[model samples]
Target: QAAERLRLSARTMHRMLRVARTIADLAGAADIATPHLSEALGYRGIALAGTRDAA
Candidate 1:
C-alpha cells in the first residue's frame, strides 16, 4: 500500500522501512506504525492524501 501510494520502486520500499524503523526507535515506540511510515514516505514526495498531481 505504501509503495503503491508513493509510486516508489521495491528498493525504495526497503529504504522507507528502514527509515520508519529508525523514526520509531528515536520516538521510543515499540514498533513502526502508520504515522511513522507516513512521515517517512512524505519526505520522499509521497503525500498522505495523494491528491496532488505535481508541484
Candidate 2:
C-alpha cells in the first residue's frame, strides 16, 4: 500500500526497508516494526520535500 501510494520502485522500496531495518537496529529492536517503517517513510518525505518528486 505504501509503495503504491508513493509510487516507489522495487529498488526504492528495498532501500526503505534497509533504512527501516537500521532504525530498528538503533532502537535495539530484533525486527523492523511499523513505527520504524513509518519513520523511514517520514524521513523520505522530508528528504523529498520541495523537490520535484514530492507529492
Candidate 3:
C-alpha cells in the first residue's frame, strides 16, 4: 500500500516499519497502529523538508 501510494521501495518500507514500531512501543502500545505509522511518516516528512529548506 505504501509502495503504491508513495512509490516507496522495500528498504524504505522496512525503515518506516522500524520507526513506527519504536514509536508505538514508546507510547505503550502493543502494536504499530495506523496513527503510529502516520506520525512516523509525518516526522520523516518534516525532517526531509527542513533539510531541503536549510540547504
**Candidate closest to the true structure, highest TM-score:** 3
Candidate with more favorable, higher TM-score: 1 or 3: 3
Worst 10 residues of 3 by lDDT: 1-10
lDDT score, candidate 3: 0.89
lDDT of 1 by residue, 6-43 (tens): 58898989988999999999999999999998888777
**Cα RMSD (Å) per model?**
4.7, 3.0, 1.3
Candidate 2: deviation at residue 15, Å? Answer: 0.9
Model 2, span 1-55: residue lDDT tens: 9899879999989989999999999999999999999999898887878585655
Clashes of 2: 0
Error of 3 at 5 (Å): 1.1
Per-residue lDDT, model 2, residue 4, is 94
Sort by TM-score, best first.
Answer: 3, 2, 1
The list of candidate 1 runs beyond 4 A from truth reads 46-55
| Model 3 lDDT per residue over 1-55, tens place | 7666998778877888899999999999999999999988888798889999999
Q: Model 3, stretches more than 4 Å misplaced? A: none
